[model samples]
Target: MPIRMHDTLRRKKVDFSTIEAGKVSMYVCGVTVYDRCHLGHARCYLSFDLIHRWLEQSGFDVHYVQNFTDIDDKIIHRANELDGDWKKLVDENIETYYEDMDALNILRADDYPRCTDYVDDMIRITADLIEKGNAYVADDGVYFSIESAPEKYGMLTGQILENVRSGAGGRVDDTGKSKRDHKDFALWKAAKPGEPTWDSPWGAGRPGWHIECTAMSMDYFGAQFDIHGGGHDLRFPHHEAEIFQGECHTGCSPVVHHWLHNGFVNLDGEKMSKSLGNFWTINEILKKVDAMVLRFALINAHYRSPIDMNDALLNDAERNYNRVLECYVTSLKGCLAENNVPLPVADFASTNPLSKSLALLEKMGEGFAKAMDDDFNSREAVAKVLGAVREIMKMHNSDMDAVDSNAFSHYAIDWLEETAGAVLGVLPTREMALAEPEEDPRKLEIADEVDALLLARTQARSDKDWAKADEIRDALHQMGVVVTDTAEGPTWDLA
Candidate 1:
């Protein structure tokens, strides 16, 4: 199946088609760079990262661009509150952003255009808007005239232009003092006292919040691009303004072919916010849980679905993650056994248990791909992965005497580690996922006891004493040990 995604503009799922064949130009709206990234940020970026990985896997060469609003009211205010320079504050947070995202294993964008770096480009676009009569220069700044393009002004948000007003959050100070229309958003802001200023035709002032994205995206991907995405909060004024300014300046009909927005990260049934005191920063969460566990938790749900952040969610993710890891480690150990035999290819057509198991493992990759292709539905794709693991475990435990365990292990391990791991961006390496926990002397003593029980169980089974074998297995279970009897030996793990 071809890739199908929900476009926020159209508000429906549509088949995705890039402007350029076999290539995708994607621009995801980035952070403001004034504070540490939180779980909401992780949700947004990881959703796009999933898309990026899937695109690459689907044979599309994706050129992704994400920008940073290094200069903003938030940054300036945060700097004042911290008694630090605005640039220094942005720099610190940008570095921390990288560290946090890298920890989550989000793929880096091809270009990260800072707002301050593209002041010249912003000024040029602002000037062009004025020359085209799409924007007007006010006493304080340049504002994009919403009246200039009435039909396309509110197309993105599906709001009537007449009822739209400025100052709807993330809007520039469009106080009705000098603007023509209340809906007219700021393209450029005039210089303020003691604030970062850039040289422009209007005066030494900085670019507006929405204009920076238009400038940077156009600079990187030209007038039109394949996909523009951000959090659902941006669907309104921030992205709406991008569509207005981009099309008006470039004289293009559609600025971006598809608009993707990931849903919010809710905390305990409420939206996460700093003021509400429900916000959990990525760094803070990482200190408690494994990074891959967090990534798995975030991706376990559909990207467009709101994920509830809580201890329960993390715990569930850790449990599921351990199940996958256990299967992978078991497969690796079985494959590395010296006396294991390979299943014959000629026997594949026969009704042999090993051949049936191998056939199931081979089809898992296609199942994974099919799930991803349907709107990048990661939740379903992850289900397929876990389903494959369950099948592998059933074969290992129930069909061990009839199947070639080594052959099944080789195929399952490669598919889980290479194919599924590549797009999921988790469980890539064995050491990371399956590393042994630090040995405790007390636990070591328990391990010796568990081994002795397993040895007795094996001997009982070999001596045809079924009742004794069952008794030993019951003792191991009571001691919190889960033992699976195989043809080679009994594999034990802590319950």
Candidate 2:
């Protein structure tokens, strides 16, 4: 099946095609470099990662670009709030961003153009807009006249120019700023006392938030590209501004063919926000679950659907992740067994366990592709993977070593690596996925406490106080200890 995806601009699913045949040019808006990346960032980036993986697996040459806003008001404000150098803070946070993102296995973009590096390009673009009568120099800075190209105003948000929100990439305040029209946004901002500044024709100031993206994206992908994506929050002013600047400057109506936006990360039915204290950084969540488990949790839902992140979602992810990992390990074990017999059934269509299992595996493989083809439906694709695992689970270890089990084992290995490992990116090596988890030193010190609880439970059972015994057992469970009565006394271990 050909790939079809939900285009945010058209507001419907359509067949995905590239400007150049067999090639894709994609740009995903990147972080502001003011802080660590949180779960919301993970969902957005991983959503693109899933799309990138599938495109390559389906045989398209994908050239991906994700930029960094190393110079922004937030970065400067954060630096001043912490009494640190803005450049140093931006550098450290960009380093941390890569560390956090790489931990989740997001593929690096082909180009990472920093906004600061493209100031000259932005200055030229802003100057050309002014020369062409689309922009004007104001006391504050150069502002793009919305009235010059009002037709591009409501392309993404569907609101007309008069009714559009004054949300221009988080630039809300109009304090002491001069503009010809109230709706006009900045092309360059006049330098402030302590903020970073660069030389431009208008003044010694930096480019505006919207113009940086226009300069950088056009520099890489010409005037138009295949896809432009970011978090759902960026669709309104940021992307709309990009379109306004790009099309007005290049005399092109549509600058990008597809505009893709991932849904927000919610917490307890509310949008996750730092103000609400519902935010969780990617590093913080990594301590609780395996990286692959986190990947499974985030991408388990469709890319365009809201993911209400909570413990329930994570627990389900860990359970399903273990199933896939265990099946992979079992397949590896079967292939490595020394005394395995390689049956020479060249046609291999006889009615046996191996033949039936192979047929089912082939069917599941097709199902996985079909689901992935339909807008990267990872939820259904994962079900197809678990479906294949079920088929393998029904076969015993010895049966996997049966007549033509080698073919089944090899087939399982290849199927998982291609579909799950390469496309979904939820599959990793068994050793890496099941590596020895960090042991808590505090857990080692709980042995004496566990012994006391077990002794009390034994005494309660001897006294026919069944409720007391059950209560004691529950207490142990609260401490993450599991107990089972053996022919000897009860044996205990951490759950």
lDDT string, candidate 1, 206-258, tens digits: 88889989999998889899999999999888998998889989989798999
**Model 1: number of backbone collisions:** 0
Off by over 4 Å in 1: 165-176, 337-350, 398-403, 439-495
Predicted structure with the largest lDDT when compared to the true one: 1
lDDT comparing candidate 2 with the true structure: 0.85
TM-score of 1: 0.86
lDDT of 1 at 345: 54
lDDT of 2 at 351: 70
Model 1 residue pairs with clashes: none
Model 2 residue 305 CA deviation (Å) reads 1.0
What lDDT does the true structure give each of the candidates? 0.86, 0.85
Where does candidate 2 stray beyond 4 Å?
165-176, 337-350, 397-403, 433-479, 483-493
